[model samples]
Target chain A: MKSTYLALILVLASAPLWARTTPEELAEHPRWKALLHINQGTTWRYQGRSYIDDPDFFLHESGATDARAELEASIEQLRSSESEARCDFPARYRFLSQQLDWPDDGALSHCSEYQEWRGAMPEERVALIFPASYLNSPSSMFGHTLLRIDHGEDEDGVWLSRAINFGATVQGQENSILYVYRGLFGGYPGYFSNVPYMNKIRDYAHLENRDMWEYQLNLDEQEREWLLAHLWELEDIEFDYLFLDENCSFRLLELINLARPESGLMNDFRLAEVPANTVSSLDRAGFIESVDYRPSKANELDALVKQLDATEQDLALALAADHAVTEREAFRELEPRRQNLVARTAYAHLRLQNREGERSQAAAERGMALLRTINGTPTVSGIEPERPVSPEKGHGTKMLAAGGGMLGDRGFGELQARFSYHDWLDNPDGYLNGAAIEAFNARIRRTEGDDLTLEQLDVVNIKSLAPRNSFRKPVSWFVNGGLDRRFIGEKRHLTRHIQGGPGLAWELGPVMPYAYAMARAENNSAHEVLVSTAAGARAGVLWYADGFQLGLEAEGLYYHNDDRRYRPSATLNVPLGRNHALRARIERDGGPDRAETEFHLSWRYYFD
Target chain B: MRKTLLAAALVATSFGAQASAPGGSGCGWGNMLFEGNDGMPMHVLATLVNGTSGNRTFGITSGTNGCDTSGALSYHGENMLAQAGVMEEVAQDMAVGDGEALTALSVSMGIPAEERDHFKKTMHENFSTIFPSEDVTAEEVMANIQKVMNQDKQLASLS
Candidate 1:
């Protein structure tokens, strides 16, 4: 009887050790859900299954959709020595081992490849890098975001740090139209790449002339390790690239959220992920540790030119144009400091010109000579470029406005909504000067006793007014296409039209005046043909001050069918705060058959 | 005057041809520098749709994308500046005896902060030798830099 009692006690004592963790329990873990990128939304659905689009990323057949199955398969695969699971999914292995009391049997130590890669890139710190908007490039018009991994500064500093970039793996030599189509519709596979930080600086600051902002992250060491482990597991993984939402910035936020689940970096960025808005979100979430700005080559040259007088600027320009100008009295009469400045400016100009054109022997020789002259003189202290307002300080990307306005003899209440971006009359605190980009802007009006009618719907509108200066003469241009209600004789009809052209703009202090000779193609109900084209001209003056904006514009169009139209408009915007504004606009539209006058005052609110 | 200019051009072309073909080490630095020069259409299109030209490296090798791991001018077993296109910037910075590119190069060479000014001064004085011509390759520039640094007491220890 005593032996039987002892046997029962022994059986009871070993019961807890034999109890195994169920797949359901492991699958329900928060870390497991994060590893699978399982977010609570219909937008993240892929193939009517899970968020991950890549089949290779899953270990089980239904791993993409079935978390419990994936966990079971992962556990089984991890136990086998011949399987690639340990190396292929190190982050999963690390998590599983920590959660379950796995024996220290050298399972992780066998992952030589993962060990080597992890050892090579010891991530002690991370920084979110934002290459600011370059309006000239369509892809960069919204800016770009990436991550830089710093292994605590050695003698080499962070210049050799590794930069993690996620972008579409675009196919070969596609045309612009096809490229845009593929980019918008997820026809391309996006992947994460690791590159040296210096290469990025060279590409952005030197070649593309885009300034970069680096925001150091405050992730703890444990969080950084978790992030790096997940990053390694994503090697060669592909994600469907959607230009608007599932883009580079969005994927970066996913990685960040995986590191600190409580951070919720991806929560409020479901609809649209503007790069600047993401930066603002990071700032709000307290992920930003510090901020640093690196100026572009153009900014550097501009700063240098600002130090010189008008005659000296002319001299520098001459030296850049003609190498023989260096021997002239005008050049030799300057002090050594001034001479150094002129030579530096000339060299920068030559470099910039060479970047845009084929290499010329004469220009190269001139550049070499200028460098020699610069080296012979005593080195001057470098001048720092003026820093503009940071992107996060700008008003949000989406806007909504409500107001009452008069159109001809009718008074109406109008509600306007813009899906994205900045416009000329919007606050220009953090946006590029003289630049405007809007997409999917819609206005609906309700007449005093009538039903609501769509007034206008703009699919895309973009404008860049780069002003001409003594040092740089950039061409200004605008393009817009949309549906608008136009006066056709005595009735208003919806017309589809696209207009664009190139022009020149000059900056007079805070006021910029621009003019464009435009051509338009439209499908109007009143047109004699299905599609009618028109030639027109547009002139505008924009004045930006403290927190206020004013724009005066006029346009004239002559259609192919002998229809003439003239329009003049003025808009004034006053900011109540960063996200609130009051705008007033007045316009007179005159056609060959009829004329109408309209005015409106609106209160606008902006959000991300 | 036109004849003299033509003669100088011919001489430069011949010199360029004779001087050890820029990227003889198979690092393709010259090609990298001239990468986006395929006219405005492609440049505008590529930059418009995708921010990058889609040349990606999955970290299979130690040096991920542009750098050639087998190159002579390597740091931590990976070439730091082989295909970065920063050679021109570095040359300009070297001429001025101070700039961001100069500092980056010094750091890549493992020069300590206290010795960076000396390194920059050394490179500044040797700018002509480092960049003898516009067609000078990154390998040649690196070789020249190492030669000059080897001659300097403070920088020699770091290099």
Candidate 2:
């Protein structure tokens, strides 16, 4: 009996050698295509091999290219030996087995460290956190996205949970200009990092004063486990960061696609992935369960200030000021609740003031003393503002405008469009109010003589109109550049123009008034001088109501070569619906000739 | 005149005891050197970082940057970060007597929701002692809180 059993074991062991697979046969399998696709492997015909985008994600020698060959080799290796640290084998193994109808042998095994990490990872829930657009920083203008892995109880544990952040690990110090250049042109290598959610909250909510929105993913336990495992597989993997395409938003979408391949989150986002666009895509995939908002310090203070009476607000300011004896005395004379209100308001006011370097050290100390004086006072002023609409709720970022009107004595047909982003009067419901950012805005005109001309091409235009308040004195600003059609006497000529300036803006009831001292430089194509620099002043007032917005501006410019001009403009924006608007603009230019007037009426549509 | 004499005697004896004791010191220069008394250096460092970290008191109030009560517990057991942060919020919402600052303070102190009203009342009544002047430190604020707690049986029991 022993001799017979030995003979049978030898025969069984030799059976797998009889039908070994060729590389060609392995490559033909559908399972191989799926596996290679998930690894982000592409055939480099010139190099005559395949390579994976993330080198660290796969362990097999041919894992980067020739997915079938790698799979067949890995399966053979796994069957032969144990304890190999093929970190990504388990998922591939399971996928191949189920797709190819292979036997359920426990051949694929994880290393001890990988197993330990898997056990330690959260299995219940996942959340996508987006810190909204921070216009102050060039990098975060499109906003940023990260994933939070919930390990404990739902609500409260979110604060202490771990997060996965993918960012470009800049090698050394770079100034803001260099940083932007490097970021846009793939000058930095991006890497994924794991950090606690508290760190992000610190950076966004308090330090940056940007609100955060958390969208809990509707992934089940199995999906969450798969995502967690894949995240671990991607640990320390490096990818060249391209600001436009392979950016934070794009990479996160790719990661999601790995876990839920059927959703194909990365399918339509091959070219560019705006943060809000990616968020909308996730919603479309039916992955988002619910959303939670965490207000920034600025938002909280704004809400709190709205609730305070004028006298209480004054007392609050006085308490924050170092030398306001009269206000302090008046504050003390108030009732207990009022006193607490004044103190709380003062404390909040000082905190915001300190951000702009407006508060002195002594005044700050007094602010703390005022708080301690009213400690435990039961003033229930938890005035959280109603949450803003989600970015997905806003109209699509791209805009198309079409209409026609007259330019001086000529009748013309006009078409204008912008590739991205919001404008101040474009139904500021789901966007940052009073903020406008436009990229690649172009306008083309057709004259009555059937001549098509490019009127303007704006490379970038960003305007931030932050209104001043009692607590914050922010300097609003504008920056714009590109080719513009300026009327030189009677004919229109395209000029290369770059202009920006710092300005002050104040909100008075429904009208916001602003003034700016601008330095403008332009190179007119049909001018005697190649470049002309001008020092100009512009003042404008914007009156806005429910669905109506009207703006009026007057500007006077003095060029370096004793050329002087004055331009006055007015724009009226009326909302047609949620995603459409009608606008009428009129401008008068006074130069060597009499003032020339250009009027236009256009209809604008915002997409989804 | 009699009271002044007693105060002088008390000061003299206290100074003599501090001078002769082994490793005993005042809070000033000694605290900076070896932290022999008051741990004033650590408190000062905490205060300076808290004020200069570009977050201001709002960072602490919002529980960002680890600016919570657990961190920077001064020698007198006062959470300086919390004290500075809560003051701002308390001053903002004083009329209602309830705000994020007070809520955070209560949560950190393990005060039950039912006892918050009493806690607020005690602090409001003892405000004069807690903040006797505009230059009061977090330690003085905490010490005054303890004194207030001792005088109120409900607060003392809760603490």
Model 1, A242-311: lDDT tens per residue?
Answer: 7777788878888887787666564442777788988998999899988888988788888888889999
- What TM-score does candidate 2 get on C-alpha atoms? 0.75
Give candidate 2 regions above 4 Å deviation. Answer: A1-54, A73-81, A87-110, A118-120, A323-327, A354-364, B1-159
Residue-level lDDT of model 2, residues B83-149, one tens digit each, is 2233433333332455444444554465766787788766666666755654445556667777888
Tens-digit lDDT track of model 2 for A1-608: 53344345335323554235455654544334334444232111213233236654445665666565666665665443352534445555544444444555554443555555555455567888888866443335567788887754334435445567666654323454565576667666665655435546645665467788899988877666556655554554566666666677766776676566556454342445678887888999898999998888778777777777887776667666753543456765878776666666666666555432222446545555655654645455456866988777777788999988887788899999999888777777667766788889999999898779998899998887778878778778888899987666766678899998988898876788989888889999656888889899889988877788888999888888776678899999998877899999999876765567889999999874
Give each prediction's DockQ, rounded to 2 decimals.
0.12, 0.04
User: Highest TM-score, which number?
Assistant: 1
What is the DockQ of the complex in model 1?
A: 0.12
Instruction: Specify the poorest-scoring 10-residue window by lDDT in model 2 chain A.
Output: A42-51
Against the true structure, what is each candidate's TM-score?
0.87, 0.75
Error of 2 at A26 (Å): 9.3
Candidate 1 Cα misplacement greater than 4 A, ranges: A1-21, A42-44, A47-49, A80-83, A154-156, B1-78
Cα DockQ of the candidate 2 complex: 0.04
What are the candidates' interface root-mean-square deviations?
Answer: 13.0, 17.4
